[model samples]
Target chain A: MKLTDLVSRELVNLHLQGSTRDEILREMADVLAANGRLLDKDAYLDAVFAREQEGSTGIGFGIAIPHGKSAAVKTPSVAFGKKPEGVDWNSLDGEPAHLVFLLAVPETAEGNEHLKILQMLSRKLIDDEFRQGLLQAANVDEVMALLETVE
Target chain B: MISMKLLAVTSCPNGIAHTYMAAEKLSKAAEAMGVDMKVETQGSIGVENELTAEEIAAADGIIIAADKTVDKSRFVGKRLLEVAVSDGIRRPEELIRAFSEGDVPVYGQGQADAGSRLKTIQEIKQARKSRQNPVYRHLMNGVSYMIPFVVVGGLLIALSLGFGGHPTAHGMAVTPGSFWDHVLQVGTASFSFMVPILAGFIAVSIADRPGLVPGMIGGYIAANGSFYGSTAGAGFLGGIVAGFLAGYVAKWIKTWKVPQMIQPIMPILIIPILSSAVVAAIFIWIIGHPIAIVFSDLQSWLQSMQGASKVVLALILGAMISFDMGGPVNKVAFLFGAAMIQSGQYFIMGPIAVAICIPPLGMGLATFIGRRRYTKDERDAGKAAFAMGLVGITEGAIPFAAADPLRVIPSIMIGSMCGSVIAMLSGVTDHVPHGGPVVAVVRAVDNVPMFFVAILVGIVITALIVNLLKKEIPADEETEGVA
Candidate 1:
């Protein structure tokens, strides 16, 4: 229902260090794995890449929501990663993605609750200040504080 | 006087979270500004807290903070400001203060947005660079313009005949030297104007302003047939050829590099003159008689359809009318039926009218009778769709088709086909070019009982079939939806 419920401070990275799009997806997937959200890290990464092949999750506005609905995911969760230098995520507008919301939904998540979380993030990202605040956040606490206002 | 009431709409992607966030932010900002504000949210679920017509009418300034396309048709003639939903979240004060600032541009006043047109211009340039199908676009433009004229002409003639004329050897005849006779005469005159308007606007759609004169001239010639010294002109078929010829010739002339002094007069003088001459010459010398021959022959063939053949024709026409649900195929079939009305073949249009209402009315009924088969958004849409069907608009079924085309399309098509076939078999005849019970109530239809029966049966069949085909959402979600 709210970002704080799906997103944790441990998964919010103020500075995401990755060059290529795939590496960034893997890094974000690893965040979920480290937080015990995924049962298998490699499988989730593979699912994310498979979904990317259908179309880039880069939904323009310098934002990419790379997500996978896979059995590897043990729970529905979100991992926030901000790339300061921006990566070419093959976006709709061909712009570099500075803000990334990695969505992981369990294969059996019939409620589509993870999709709802993605909806919340996607809606707020339309606000330039929210994106800017999240991007400008000094640490995980600042990121968590901004996301708390999502409800 | 500044009107304190404000309306705002928020949307972005399919996510539910951000929409509420922005709405919360805007309401607070509106409160601070002493503005009575109501925010509407369009999310994955559906439109929540829709603005009533009264609220929309009473509101002084409107703000549309949407990241997706919102139909701005209703907001026409309103002082409106639209910004990204993010703007509402980030800069609400700036958006609200714009009402007092008087810098907000009025939207939907029959003008394209200045900034948005920049995209259209760029896209047009890109399209021209590739030379994509402008022909289809121009033809559709002609059809759109032609429709209103056809409706006016068709209904007037139908009403005049129904009220004032008796059955005659040839169609119906108004009483000589009576008030009914004058109404019939005026109605016939309106019908005669239909062809030229169709041709003129088709050309307008094709070559912009310059093609209008030539297209209209060509259409008049096509309709009269006497310009080419032939009887029965070419009918709507000839008008189509004339429209295309005039549009293209005008478009060709526009491409020529003229001197700067003469360029100013090209659209006003040179292009129209040259194009009209070309269209006249070609229609008279090359294509005019052949088109008239074909039109007349086809008109005779349609008038002769009887029994099983008529039922077959109605079935085909019905399926075509419902198949695309107001796409190119539907328009072509509708145009054919309207053109048939001009030729005094009322039965050809009878089934088409019935088919038109079946889809909308059926879909609406389906939602009501089989409530579990739809989500909450669909049930809400169902009410509007049903009402649209009563007035004979087929496009009301579009959302269901869009949601699940494979199932919805076939169901609606079957229902429309059955209705059309039954209407034809029962000898239902509509004089008016329009469909639905509203038109029938005005004595536009003969065999009115069968007409109603055909429509009711068709609506029921469509509702049953579509509901059976559609999978139900979890029932718990309905409770959640209300919550």
Candidate 2:
């Protein structure tokens, strides 16, 4: 349930080049699939889209957390993506999102595993310094090392 | 000598919160801007601070900020400013300034050349015409009265299942010839009228008295799927369609002029017959078939989902339940689960039950764990929401979500979805058409131990996530101003 245990270097897209919301989601799903952590890319995409239809996961403060529990997921994982120019997420504060957390939980995990991961991420995201550090990290390895302290 | 008066009306959905908020804001803004104004509030109890007919006659302009219908025929000859209730809440100062500056235009029959009065009159007329149509006025009147039935019926059935029904090998059932069976049946029968009433009022709102028969018949067909080909028929949504169909049909039929001898009969007889046939045919052939197909497909898809697939399903449901905190999307997911309960699939309800409690319980727990993160209004609502959550009322989370949708929605969704997945994996099931811990306590849920576990886990997850997501409240601000 640790942040590092769930996120991989390959899954981290430090520079996302998408302009629209759907494109960003597609790009994030691609990163997870490329890392061999997903069973079906389409299914994972469907799960993300389905969650979005319910409401945007953008929890304000220039942050968007798009997560879903899907059978396509081989294991629970988190993908961190930073948009340097910021993406319009229709945030409550009406600010573009600079930091995106894409959480992929295995559909069958038991004993509150996903919950534990979510709690860790939510806590860390609230701190301005932690958020700044995550956004300012030079590369994926630096970001991964920073996340290690969360657990 | 030149003289003019301005009259204004304000309203909101809940009538208590936003209504007063808008009224207070508008009053303050108008006073500061130095404008002559008399405001009337049409709230839940009824319209207060009566606006006299003389006031309407003399007023050069009118401002209406309301979600519900406001009678505008009285202001048919005046200038008006019409805007959403949110405008009043967020931009009252600007709105008042615009009105005082004569920025709005004249509308309706009062377009005479007072030259200076032209702009003010035009604005008032535009506001009045766009407020709420006569049809919507009547329809809302009916919906307002009809909501109590839906709430009462839904709650009663939930209560019966939770307290009186026992889990049999077949499913959750009340013992034959038992008193509880009658009570549950009565509650269900009350619910049966929901669709008919919805349609009837919609028609009555549109075509006055003549549209009733056609509307009711249309609603009945909409709710009963035998008319089409699906076992699972349309519910309240269909009622809305039927109401509009019947109203328009009746209106169209009434316009056909017959011989002088048959004129009276035409209003009573011909209109009803023609409108009913049109409504019934549309439901049976056009609208009914497509709706039936979709309903059946949804049912089959739900039934076909297996163990792992169920987890994915749970996550989607949980996320939706917590998303808007009882807004349209939340209602859709909740209603879908409730509909499935009548068809003997309790598993779908299991995840819903867990999801419902997450937001309130989570937020409530946050207050205890991190008191500095929430305002006093939120903290107070948190306690009540937690209690409501224990009984499975998802609406308990509305205050928090409304206050901060971005942070609160995702936090709650993640926690609730996690709980839903766990419940689904455990094979928990619920038999009632409602959710909440209250339903489970009454024996409505299958595998009671798992149900309790699911709810407990969901609550814990939500609390943890919320506490983590939120920043501590600033210590400098007084807690009394938190709301």
Candidate 3:
């Protein structure tokens, strides 16, 4: 239920290397795959892209929450990526996304668990302090430390 | 004395993003103004942080900003301001100011009206200015009530088919005197009340509680033209007339200046009696015959269509379903399909079901096929959209289409149209009121393979067309976070 439990050190990228949206999503999905949250990287990535075709999850304020509820996900999880150079997320406000969270939930996630996570994160995301902490974090541990302060 | 604490509730239709945003704005404004408050949000997951009965009692005022219904029985005696959820977002401080100025009206002693109509001349003017939204609102009010009946009744009948029905020449028929027969009967019983309740609520929405009796009466008459010695009863179309006519009549009567002594009895006696009589007379003479002709013509036209002609109808419905992605137009199309289910025209819904799933499914597939066009974040979101679309949640495509409505809308509409036409052409039939291959694979749909094929073809078309239309991803823009 906690976002920390769903997000892992392996999935958190302190410095994003991808210049394009596709590269960032692939790198982050690979991170999730490495962390054992994804069963099939290709299937999961397809789901992620499919979700984007529906709408950009770049909800504004330099953030993008790229998420999918797919059978390829082993667990409900979130992967974080930081892009100081920013990436085109085609956000609601047409701003590029800087802080990216790739959320994956099982197709059978009981009672829309992903949406609940998104809502919980949305409130925290609205706070200036939380974004400041995440942006200023240096390492994986530092990111974890910042995420722990979600409440 | 210091101002007493106030409480508010905010909700919108989706109840996810906007509802929370509104709640946040309202509570933040309240806190900044040094007022003690609690804000409850009715969201997709349901009510959060509900107000206690004691809290309702202790509150000095309440603001109910909602697009959907919010039960106010608990706040019966409180000073309340009821407005659209937009007010909670855009004018939260202004709403709080009204409470500070003690301008809101107290409810539960009588009707819990939104605000008092203290002015006479301006009241009519105020009413006219608000008319545009009210007509649509009133119709939605009727549709809202009518939907529960349709969904539950239709589903129960579907369940009856799944559990207790065997196919006849026309469709599934429950065995006489069996338990499934009883279930089917119950569902039929529910459907029987659909028009009356729809008419009743629309009138109540328009004319308040006084419209209830006359509206129901007029609706009952409309639904059963035997009262006027007509062979074919006026259908839902007639119900609309009855509801609006009764509502306006009751509303007009409320504008009358009865003597002070007669005012007490006016609402209970004179208004209901006069309006009911007038509505009945008008409906029997003027409305019923004309609407009956139109309704039957429509029913027959729909019923008689076949082959290519049927596909045309299916195409229009499919496009409508995917056009706004569950907005008002989509709801109207859905309601049309549901009405068909009640009349035992299962094939129309067959196509609608296919159309409903294609937008999300096709959009999801588009991301998969054209990976180079989308950003890394988008591709990931596409996976989720694909999954949601598979399960028949059309909203999965919303985020994508909302951002680029021009290309996305046309693409999804075409995809849905292709799927719908295919479903109709393939002779697919859906017994259940709901859509998607989920329903079909579960045996709620007839010709399951064809249904799957229709969905598949539509998804391919959508994915191909959209990916073809999509431009290459834009370079990153300047970020906006101070952090």
Candidate 4:
């Protein structure tokens, strides 16, 4: 039930190297694939892009949450990627996204614990202090500690 | 300010993130602002922390942050602020501040929270008003205002007569200058205002404030038959007529395109004076003549029925008593029986006695039988009607008659006629001028058992028929009665 349970050290990137929105999504999707959370990387990326086509996942205030519920996903997982220099993801407020949370939800998922944790993260992102903590986190342990309070 | 509470409902199309996010943001903002608040979240997991009716009713304001449709019927009378889900997340404090600043619109007052804003409150009210039968709407408005006066007057008189009255040769009477006597007079005073208030408010519903003076003045004339050189006033029926007369007259005068200088004083000065004079003249001269003629004609008709069959006579007497419910027609029949009691015809008084109590008793039973057919106030009035019927106060049925005259009047009339026929055929005889089982209790009636049987049959007939004729009042239509 803990938010840390859905997120692992392997998926946490303190410094994202991607300069564009496409490169950042590919990098985050690669992290989920590397952790064996996705069965097919291309199909998962297609779902994410379809969601983006419907509406931008960039929700202003230096945050972008690109989520996809597809059959390619084998397990529910969250990949956290932070860029010191923000990237433009066509956010609502037209601000660059500094904090990126990539969510992978299986189309036929078994439990809703990860979804609940995602909801918690969505709610917490509205708080300036929580976003500040995410941006200033020095290492994966510090980031995990901050996210530990979400659940 | 510390006691204030806010209620909110948040929803979205996806229902996973935005719903809870908006709810969380609003909750956090409320916490920071030190406002007690509850947010009902309608998310993918389904409704959680649902707001209760009590909480919604007690809330100072409500916030509806939804991207999808949210049913707002439950929040009818509450102050509400509606915004998109994104606004709820980004501007939670601002939304709460709208409540603190009292900038929220009351739901059902022709205003919504977000889009589809109504142009003006008056336009919406007028639109709603026009949807119903205007006359029925106006009459209902009058009845709502008139109910309190009826309840207070009926209950007070019933108490005074039941507890402190003695069975007298004339009727039940309390000792002079006693506490019960004072209470009785106070009850009479309350009753005196019943017709005038009914008329005044009916006009208020029709022509607004300008119609009040004329309506009340016309009602005063209607209630006092002496103005028209008649013995009894026209009663609640007459009050209804006067109310419409004054209302339309005032409404007509309001339409005149008068000069700018005169327009300011029109509602206060010109409209009331002119309408009052017109309604008073019309009631006193035009309506009064017909009422007097009807009273005298009924008096002679009853006199001519002296040699008629006993069953036919009982039927006529019962019909008269319940027809207008203490109005002109009722008064004529009652006086004839009282006069006959002076002539040693005790049997004539028996049927009259049974008929007198049937309307109120039947209505009271009807309310009990069909709870959904009457409003909360009417159900309360029903209980009081029973007590008043026991004490032989015919005016107890006036509220019911005034409310649904067509159906209720016919139903009560049939019940009274049946009871009257039963009392007559069973050879029941009442020595006192009064009516009801109370007279039999005081040893004023012969064949006491049959007297009760007559009343029971009448009550059953009325309760069954009225319930059959009436439809169930819709839940939305059961707004809390003004009374």
Best by DockQ: 4
For residue B365, what is the lDDT in candidate 2? 80
Name the candidate that leads on lDDT: 4
Give the alpha carbon lDDT tens digit for every residue of B113-183 in model 3. Answer: 34333323233222222333567657656655665564455556656756676544333467999998988
Model 4 C-alpha lDDT per residue in residues B130-206, reported as the tens digit of each score: 34577987888888898888888988998888788877768788999999999999998989988998898899888
| Residue B13 in candidate 4, Cα distance off native in Å | 13
Please list the residue runs of candidate 2 whose C-alpha ends up more than 4 Å from where it truly belongs after superposition: A1-151, B1-130, B133-139, B169-171, B307-310, B316-349, B352-419, B425-435, B442-483
In model 4, the Cα lDDT at residue B391 comes to: 81
lDDT of each: 0.73, 0.70, 0.73, 0.87
The lowest-lDDT stretch of 10 consecutive residues in candidate 4 chain B is: B115-124
TM-score of candidate 1 to 2 decimals: 0.36
Q: Comparing 2 and 4 by TM-score, which wins? A: 4
**Candidate 4's C-alpha lDDT?**
0.87
True contacts kept of 3: 0.12
Residues B357-403, candidate 1, lDDT per residue (tens digit)? 89878988999999998766667667766765765656566556644
Highest-TM-score candidate: 4
Clashing pairs in 1: A119-B15, A126-B86, A127-B86
How far does residue B198 in candidate 4 sit from its true spot (Å)?
A: 1.4
Candidate 2 chain B, run of 10 with poorest lDDT: B110-119
Count clashing pairs, candidate 4: 0
Better of 2 and 3 by lDDT: 3
Kindly report, for each predicted structure in the order presented, the TM-score of its chain A compared with the true chain A.
0.92, 0.93, 0.90, 0.98
Measured over all alpha carbons after superposition, the RMSD of each candidate to the real structure, in angstroms, is 20.2, 31.6, 23.2, 12.4
Cα lDDT for residue B265, model 2? 87
